[model samples]
Target: MTTTPRIAIIGAGPAGLLCARVLQLRGIEVTVYDADTAVDSRDPGGTLDLHADSGQIALEDAGLLAAFSELARPEGQAKSRLDQHGTVLSSFVPEEGDLAAPEIDRGQLRIMLDQHVRPATVRWGHKLLSATSLGGGQHRVEFANGHSATVDLLIGADGAWSRVRPLLSEAVPQYSGVSFLDVRFDEVDRRHPGIAALVGDGHVFANDGDGRAIIAQRNSEGRVRGYLGLRTELDWAASAGVDLADTASVRRYLLAEYAGWAPELLPLITDSDGEYVNRPIHTLPAPLTWRHRPGVTLIGDAAHLMSPFGGFGANLAMLDGAELARAIAEEPSTDAAITRYESVMLPRSGELAVQANQAIARFFAPGQAPAPDHEAEHRRYQEGAAAYRR
Candidate 1:
């Protein structure tokens, strides 16, 4: 008989929650840890697209895919692209009833995953501080909330700045010279019809083709969220004397920079409402790997962080969690299971990281020329699925 290991998952994000759910489904006991004081204590962020093969497969493993369909927005998968002059360059609409990929609010996903797990399985409000190794493939983890636990298997599903990452790898996330200024609009259809029409029902992209772009997407509740992307230094905002909190000042600065763009698209910048956030992209070096270690491993962003340009971060994280749980359930030993999980996880994430690096460079290359297909990742998934069927 295989050993039953004590599993402790740090981070109650989608990855951790899914991992715990799968393990429980397989009759394996697991616990999850998170810092959130309550389930909805914080903003659950915006919408996310879950690819069929990755995110969907993980949900299927956890037996939640059927319910997900009831809440998902398949129509939100459509997307359009525009040039600086706001010309409709290209667009994509998934065929009717295409389950290939669907959009869902991040909050909804969190609640769904959280509800399926065993009640009290996740110890909320326990902020992880550090993890220390105990001999024989065990680790003792300390949390900021005056709590601690020792587990036979420690899984870190925490995001980019993972506290558990240092124990496994020394890599650090580096700035990618790509940044986005948060732009949001509430009641888009009523308060901002022009932006609403441009956004349509899905996502819209407009690039100056010279290292500046505006990407907007329609979310639930008549809200729209987007990013004003620029290939600029991390300090560009401060250097330009732009206080990101001041929307008018940010709009003034962006308007000057995008002088020749279509007048109709200007509102995406000037009319945004809500908090302005300057987010600079960062990534752990690609092909990020570590020496085989027993008792502990990582999944999701903690294991391999890549630029969001590749559109694989969230999907991959969910897949990692599900796959890892299955490996552990099927393998004879904890050490053997961890080895099996990392072998595939490391290579896949590495390949996407490399692609993301290239895509980021190509997307912002200094020219008014057409850029790489924004739908490249989606197309690749379709092609891969087709190839698998043959």
Candidate 2:
């Protein structure tokens, strides 16, 4: 467009922050609104491997790639496949200088992006309440903090339960019947040598095709994150009379489900250093696309939420933000830019979403045949998108 537009991004996540940063670099002014009261108002989760193509490219665009590289752990590319008995079935140890995809804490990446953005770029604690269209490619957003703004373009970088998405599509995230209880071990090499040995440099995923699995990922500073996956209903904990708020109760329930698992691996359930969080996997329909509503669009999970089995969520979200920002800076109109962004983003995220569905089914299928080699199949899944190599 010939005239500069008032752009508002609703979210402070990878998609929103990266979009705002790239927009500023392109000489476009934008504002990001988030519900967070402060930066540290979160308990950081585990580390994730960002790919060369999608995530790295976005960080490069924002000029934070070198800094990200400094904080990244390249050796974290090493991964292993194991059985319930804790036998290391197979492993992939990254070669020297192999920087295909390196791991970093999710909190670190978010903080880096937050720090690089211009001051006052993000309006924190502004929980989005609703978006009312002004017609003709414009919208007025209302926040729960008694704030409001009308902008030429409104971008929904918000996550799975985005309020902005109601204007575009009727799709809601559906439960995938897989739930994860997140556990962590801290001061590990010293306090928890056994768990550290099992995790090694990267990840150890143990599955015996019995509809349950454990994924252990090595984080920086001798910390480890484990996801105890169970193929059960969303309300399984409640139905089993396990009060999640009670740590001992949660442990008892999980340990019972894993009765036959290797005694050595049981530490993942009982010996965690702290809190146990239950995250139920959910996804929007694959190939989720809207009818090109003018002046408004979505990015990241708000646009194409999928199962996290293939490590696509954060990577896709960053790519979406970067590409959408570029489109807005180049296209002639808000509608045109949105159209351009959705055209490419939809098909790509859709493909990955389908692959994620297959992965979940293969692992969670009842008495299904043993899934293929873990790292090798993961490489196949990342072939065109997030694939990494030396």
Q: Which candidate is the best by lDDT?
A: 2
Worst 10-residue lDDT window, candidate 2: 381-390
**Count of clashing residue pairs in every prediction:** 0, 0
TM-score, predicted candidate 1 vs. hidden true structure? 0.94
Tens digits of per-residue lDDT for model 1 on 6-96? 8999999999999999999999999899989877899776788888768887898899999899889988988888988999988888777
Off by over 4 Å in 1: 368-390
TM-scores, all candidates, are 0.94, 0.95
Report every candidate's CA lDDT: 0.87, 0.87
- Poorly placed runs, candidate 2 (over 4 Å): 367-390
In the range 353-382, model 2's lDDT, one tens digit per residue, is 888877887877765445445455445435
